[model samples]
Target: MAIVTPLKTAAEQTLVQQFAEAKGELPGGPAVRKLREDAFAGFEAKGLPHRRLESWRYTDLRSLLREARPLADGAKETEAVTARLASLSLTGLRLVLIDGVFAPELSALDAIPEGVTVHSLADALVQPRDDLGRILSGPSVGADDAGLALNTALMRDGVFVEIAEGTELSQPIVIIALASAESERAVFSRSVVLAGKGAKGTVVEVSEAAGSAAQQVNGAIVFETGDESEIQHVRLLTRQQAASVEVQSLLVTVGASAKFDSFALVCNAGTVRQQHFVRFAGEHSEIGLRGVNLINKAQHSDVTLIVDHAVPHGTSRELYKTIAGGEATGVFQGKVVVRPHAQKTDGGMKSNALLLNEGATMFNKPELEIFADDVVCGHGATVAQIDGDQLFYLMARGLPRVQAEALVLQAFAGEAAEFIADEAVRELVMGEVEGWLHAREAAAEVSTV
Candidate 1:
């Protein structure tokens, strides 16, 4: 059979053109227009991503887009989704963005203390400041990053959060991206967060589909941290068999004695891809990167990251764990680079996977590129199955065979869940892990019998 070429729908074309036209009318006018035009030009040159692209080899966008078009605008307010917000059991300020557009009516922001500001990008763009423009167009030439360009051209609305200097938010701030009836259509969104000097806060980003509807979501997140400030970021994606793609870039300019910690969880989605870029340019800065992924059936999950050490006396550590079953595939590619002038750099990376079936697959590539003589860097990858002996021991202790299997699976995934700092969040993720294992074991038993 010959492969058929997919044509772009009229809606998609119109969406692209709308973005190109909006650039000219932006608040910043000509300068911002030039930046948007340049990015759009790059995107046009590259076209849509294909399987031939090395970075996108596992994700075939051409095939996925054959039937999808640019998502329609979402509803101004969705009460059904707003009612479900209580289920999150979260404490602190809650900001809602429905289908890429910021919805202040459905959000709860009373907890945000003084000295902090949270508003939509559309509002921020009108402010008489060039900083936002500068950061939005900071990507250099020859970057060859397709997702960033696509987002630049199609971003409808995003969140702009700024934590003032020396202000510390005691409670975590929750940003919820809710997809409702209107969002059942396709949507593209972006979010930017800035932590000012000597500021400290925690942010949790949650994305979920409202009902049993098919939709496409593409998103990007940009984080900027300043000197002596600390930021903890958590990202969670939960959708029911819906195709979603997310590209996250974290840019941290650490000041003396600063720290940054990040956690990413990709549990349920038709297709998910995440990229993390961390650059350390300050002395005595520390960064910790951690992620946990649980994939099943035809799901695909990929996590690619780059950690650059460009200064002296910096440290970074990354640990990623994946559980794959039922023909699922997981990919992890990590690179740590130490420049020649970066002395006293300490970096370590490890990727581990648990395969529940022979059909499941995992690809891990961990690398270190060092130019300095006084730096210490190391990386390792491991793939294995559940220990039969451990399962046997549990079964021998009077537990049923299925119960024993579930316990072993929990033990394997619990290692990564232990790192979650929030007790409530940790418990919620652990419960999900157990539920997945139970469902898998029951299915296996039915097939065998």
Candidate 2:
């Protein structure tokens, strides 16, 4: 008999040990112990993901994790945190997570819409409902990703939002996740949102870090929309300069005549990877996905998507654009599949990228698998540099070379930024892009002079 050596990575081992230790310290009874043990077992069965996993080939976490430690528990709740909150001017029912732990004192939950409930996932597990298990355990038709599995095993605390039938929320709900250290620790969080029949609402999720945080943060969000419902979701990721790894998964199911739209912005993270899986289970459902990423320095950002049309008369569209410079790397992979019975399916996907420097890199893969003879599905990808003619025109009109270059970069990025429906959110993302461009130009000037 041949002996088999365990192929677990160091980070996976460390997480397993930490979970075991934490499980013993919880104040719950036997049932809680069982739940903890079962979760750990699931984690052990599926270890760290590797390059063989198609979704994670370009963004490998096992090889990137040089050290591992437990994340600081409730270390971000301080008087100084108020100052940080004041700068953003966010107005909504806020749920704050400081260093991956919920901060009840900083959170504002009063005056929320009726028929809508928001609470921590740990708290929701104790409630009486079969929907959580049914929705979470469903089979994923997309790639078998390890980052998602790791997030499931190690997730500490995140939001759980559910809307009752026929409820319409006037104000958007905000979930804020903040990281405040540059340690070698890891943060794994999860968020789940479910909308009942005829329900309509909006959700805004934002992630930020204090400074250079050499940590790992993984997240997963599952949205379920019923018949005649609508949901608008926005996700923003802006981490620090140090090495960071994040995996965000969105699983959405649209019912008959339902509409779901989502916009994502990824800026300045060490290594950020996101996957979106949207399935149209009922006829006449509509869905749209838009994303913009601005990566600089040695950062890496990857966005992968899969849209499955299971029924007839379904339509879906996806557009993603990326801007990379200063040795940065970006990746976009999108796939649309239409079943044979799903006739009259209309789907289109486009991915474009701008590489500002020779060291910057981008990889785009758009694929379509159509079984229906009458379906209309198409995909396109483009990778190119700024137009020399445009640059020369701006420089000849009395604009400095650096300023002209910045304007051109902004225009290239603005194509995707203009898709943001919310005016405030669009302005915020544009400001971040401008800041990045200005910093790059300044660095270039100093190097040249």
Candidate 3:
């Protein structure tokens, strides 16, 4: 007798079918094509991770994605997208991707900066350089996740950037991905950045889903810092609540004596999940990971970070803060692992959240796994609301209840934002924080009225 297994969910079935049919027309050579097959198989077997999985207990993917949206058309652009580009303050090279497609018309790179090389992912795939062929064809760029796999299978056009050895960029490089005027469409985008040995630079990724129809966007970033180099990365999410779902991921490898600082701010999107994977590949590497989540409404936001210490004499620091209002839900899960041979490792992780209403929910989980005898690793999490005494003090000083609460919120969130070394970036984040606070206050007034 032959038995048949039940079919996967509609969304899962659609992803598999789309990849199978569009595999050839996607990109890359045989190696990448095969990798796509393996990735699809892995996702097929697992379907979508749910509460059953330890890694995804708080946020369930299978239930959130009921049906798969069609792939986004990368070749088109809308006037709204062009209009929105005028608001960004550009002090560096700008690369804009409209609706998952690279838009050179909107980008500002009049002259190629010295000591830097740039190529679109599509261009690199067509005529792979002897040095970049193997990397471009590598399987999934070592990011292990279903969303990343989906991005790998559908990654056709993105930016591939490299900084020459010992070159310090005069200005930061900004890559903006805008999903403008797209509804029920799936956006797949990926990028790779290489900071050459002893190089110094800043790379900022801004994801904009604002002022557009509801869309599904999945993005992945792979960054490598060479020995004795320094790299700064900032991920700012400014999507609107209309977006059905979003998955943003970061994969970083720090080399010996290199320094890496990564900061993220999440203040938008209805359902957004952030996954960050950091690996210390050599000794004497230093890293700092920090983020803040400002969420409201009935939306959901999740931030999961993993930092692995695989070598001796490495150090990592992580701090995350979340503020939830209305009936929104926020989640923070962070893990640090020190291998057996990774002695002299120093790692610390801390996450704190604040709930503004009774219906608001915040899930916090911090874990430390250590196999080395000579290591200092610890993790802690705290979830709380506004301190009554603090509120009373502000209220006694003639501040309204709303203003007092907002002040307390700013103090709580500013702790994480202060970790950003760049003054400009810090100010930018603070501005966004104020904007969100005002929006929350306005919403509260409307509800009461």
lDDT (0 to 1) per candidate? 0.74, 0.78, 0.81
The regions of model 2 sitting more than 4 angstroms off are 1-6, 24-46
CA lDDT, candidate 1, residue 278: 73
Give the clashing pairs for model 1. 71-186
Which has the greatest lDDT? 3
Candidate 1 error regions (>4 Å): 1-29, 137-143, 182-184, 243-253, 442-449
lDDT value for model 2? 0.78
Per-residue CA lDDT of candidate 2, range 1-449, in tens? 99776677787778777776665543233554454466567657756666666766787767877556675555465544566666776566788877777677778877567898888866765666645555653336633555665555556677788899999877677888877664556777777788999998778888877635466777778888889998888888875554677778888888899999898888867788888888997899889998889898899999988898989999998999898988999999898989889999999899989898899999998999999999888999999988899999999999988899899888877877786666676787788789888888898899898
Distance from true position, residue 171, model 2, in Å? 3.0
* Order of candidate numbers by TM-score, starting with the best: 3, 2, 1
Q: Quote the positional error of residue 167 for candidate 1 in Å.
A: 2.2
TM-score of each: 0.89, 0.91, 0.94
Q: Tens digits of per-residue lDDT for model 1 on 412-448? A: 7777668777777677678777777777778878988
Indicate whether candidate 2 or candidate 3 has the larger TM-score: 3
